[model samples]
Target: MTSPLSSSPAWKALLAHRDALAGATAADHWQASPERGAAFTFPCAGLVVDFSKQPVAPETLALLCALARERQVPESIEKLFTGEPVNVTEGRPALHMALRGDEHAKVDGVDIRVEIQREREHFRAFVEAVRDGRWKGATGKAISAVVAIGIGGSASGPQLVLRALAPDHEGPQVRFAANIDPAELDQALAGLDPATTLLVVVSKTFTTEETMANALAARAWLEAALGPAALAHHVVAATSRPDRAIAWGLPECNVFGFAEWIGGRFSLWSSAGMPIALGLGMAAFDHLLAGAHAADLEFRSTPLERNVPALMALIGLWNRDALGAPHHVMLPYAARLEGLVLYLQQLEMESNGKRVTTTGEPLDRPTVPAIWGAPGTTGQHSFHQWLHQGTEAFACDFIVVAKAMGSDPDRHARLLAHALAQSEAFMDGLDVPDAHKACPGGRATTTIVLPSLDAMHLGALIALYEHKVYAQACLWGINAFDQFGVELGKTLAGRILPAVRGENAALTPATHHLLGIIHKLAQSD
Candidate 1:
């Protein structure tokens, strides 16, 4: 595969082709055919994705697919699924697909299927024991609340899943603490009895400072209230480093480990999602995995045009490369899916926000757009103003559910209508007489309409985006797995800790000055 540069033959063709398409608009495409929506739509894992609002002609779609082929996307995808070391810098395979409960997945001669299933069963038994009052704390009190401690993907993914599937919860109330700030953990523990609280500590290495601090603090709180033995009964871990967990005084049986092959952003499908299983029950969790597996199968087998992930990737590439969009926005109309944007923001930005290509050469093209968004109705009042008439261009995705769970029919109908209205308004902006009222209405959006918000659909939705990120990474020749960009901060923070405490001579002038101000403020306090 060749580097995807402006000078490449395929990219040059696309550049010339885009010039010819300069006059084309979303409105023009919509008006070209009444069946335009149907023509551009694809169904996968029970979600119907409508991409008609995107300004792409049939020829353009073909050319995009050709570009993908030119970049060897198919070969890349095979490497992704077959556990090749696609994460070249780290020399690890991004085999998150194995976490979706596939019974036949093998990576590096190890049957990941057996391992995943074993962990699933272990998770199920533990959840059942806790929920059924068989597993009690040191005080013999039934666990009533679970404090999930982790940061970033570890915390956000399960938090999102637990919140979305709360109705299916037959277990303890799940609370989340992701921040390094002590207040976050304190707030989560508020109103919950230490004797009845089980802390779930999650980190791949079991050494993330924020998570470990929160875990140890929670342990102290529990031990203070329930005695030292409470640590054994009240704390469990989801980690890839069981030896470290055991050394930290956690019982061997209480430590659940997943493969190191799972990236933190993609670890939710593994035992890192234990909190989700505990909150949503194993059945709902299974549905989530099954839904993702279904989407994965489709992504692996379907053609570029027919594949939902492929089309989404191509549209995203088109928006970035051809239309010159600098940002991507997500809007989920369902209130239950409020965390969707946060989850995807990390998934997209952390995965593909790279300046270099896979071959160690600097990339000349943009990788990922600045991904951001919030839930609808509330967002309608907040950032929708900028989305409507803002000067910057955006490639937006509006996710809606046809039948909302527990919502009144009229209210659900209104929600659906508002979602469609927003998409239409973006595509066909108001051409009113007043300058302020005019919406320069050619902004592109893709609407994802699900049958309803359920574990299955949510799983499929997340997996679709995962595959889409992979497809886009292939086109850009970047590794979507390794995240070296985030490590520098942690490294710097460790070196700065001593400076922040007192010493300023060893630090840079700017950092020393900042630390001096912080120390001065602290002494005043």
Candidate 2:
């Protein structure tokens, strides 16, 4: 039960190099040093990670690789793919990947794959029925729009994929609402006929605060317009808690259950992906899985130095720890990938943003950077100025889909040009004599080029980021499988509800002070 960091020689070496590395500031020296680049570059999933710009040496990487090996990183990965209970705290296997393929792979002689495949098949049939106009509303109109209701992983993952693959899409107009704010639900439901709109409730537990609230609101809206029979046409629930969904009046046939093995953030391949499958189709969904499987195979079999996910993780570690960078930006050049940054934020930050290791030991260093970004061209107009001239140095990942799925060749060329220009500008920043205008020429960045914006490539890209998060967690000695950090605020909110309703006793002094301001504001309003 000892934390991986305790026994890692690489962690020790990294700690030892702290003083020397702090004194080093020249990016050129690191890049020119053959020894440095040789150790830094690693390939996996047919992608090359050039970490030569990073400050770590070859010996450091070898030691880190050794640390990973010693910690049974390979075994952990195999356990994940083969469906072992690697999510030890939850007593479940993390088998989101199995949702896309054969579930025959076993762990402890149990086959969870069959359950995942069954859900996928059910989703596929639903998608087909809707697309073919066989699934009609109470008014006998074909479904024309979809309102996906959920928060966090349920909303972010499918929303990202749908937006990214918009060009290849030929289906119903899809909208997602994740915020708990009443405005978000109101806006998503506005101007759409309740009868022709499909409301997909995507909470795994079927009882998420935001999702359930929105579901209730949606039900009120639909019943107001089309009556109780509208519920039969408008609702579909994605949850492990099928009984809860059924209790809420969703038909058992419309309730898709994914296994506990699929964490919310990684559940896109499971029934949580009903929105994605509905927006696209069975073929597209399958392609997305196939792409991820390709990346998975490559990540498992490749050498450490050539492993893409490994190299990405190590380079990220170097940036966060060695250079003391606090933020990591992901700028996808394609407009289609606008939501990708949000998706990655959850995938990377939620998974590894831990204060303690798996064994409950305090961490010696910061874990996980603040991940944020937007699509380029648009972001260039807004935030590129800060990125180039700001005091803070944030590492960036520039993602480019190699070929545009759009029909306009000219537009595609312009997109690619912007992507290349941004990376180049970041790496080779121009010098300005004006003190306020000067650019820091040594900003670090990594470029990820997907072959195309097809479902398969998008799937691969997502899986690549997923594996990178996992590997980094392994190296950092944290549990990538759990997210206990999100619970504190929720617990506090629940406790405050009765107080807000004035049903409880008078608040404590600190709480009274806040309530005084609230009462004053209510009078002013």
> Residue-wise lDDT of candidate 2 within 57-122, one digit each (tens)?
565567567667766777777777877777766677777777665537765687766655677678
Error of 1 at 282 (Å): 0.4
Clashes of 1: 0
What TM-score goes with each of the models?
A: 0.97, 0.91
Residue range 249-356, candidate 1, lDDT tens digits: 988989998888899999998888988988877788889999999999999989887989988998899999778899999999988888888999999999999998
The C-alpha RMSD of each candidate to the native structure, in angstroms, is: 1.4, 2.8
Error of 1 at 440 (Å): 0.5
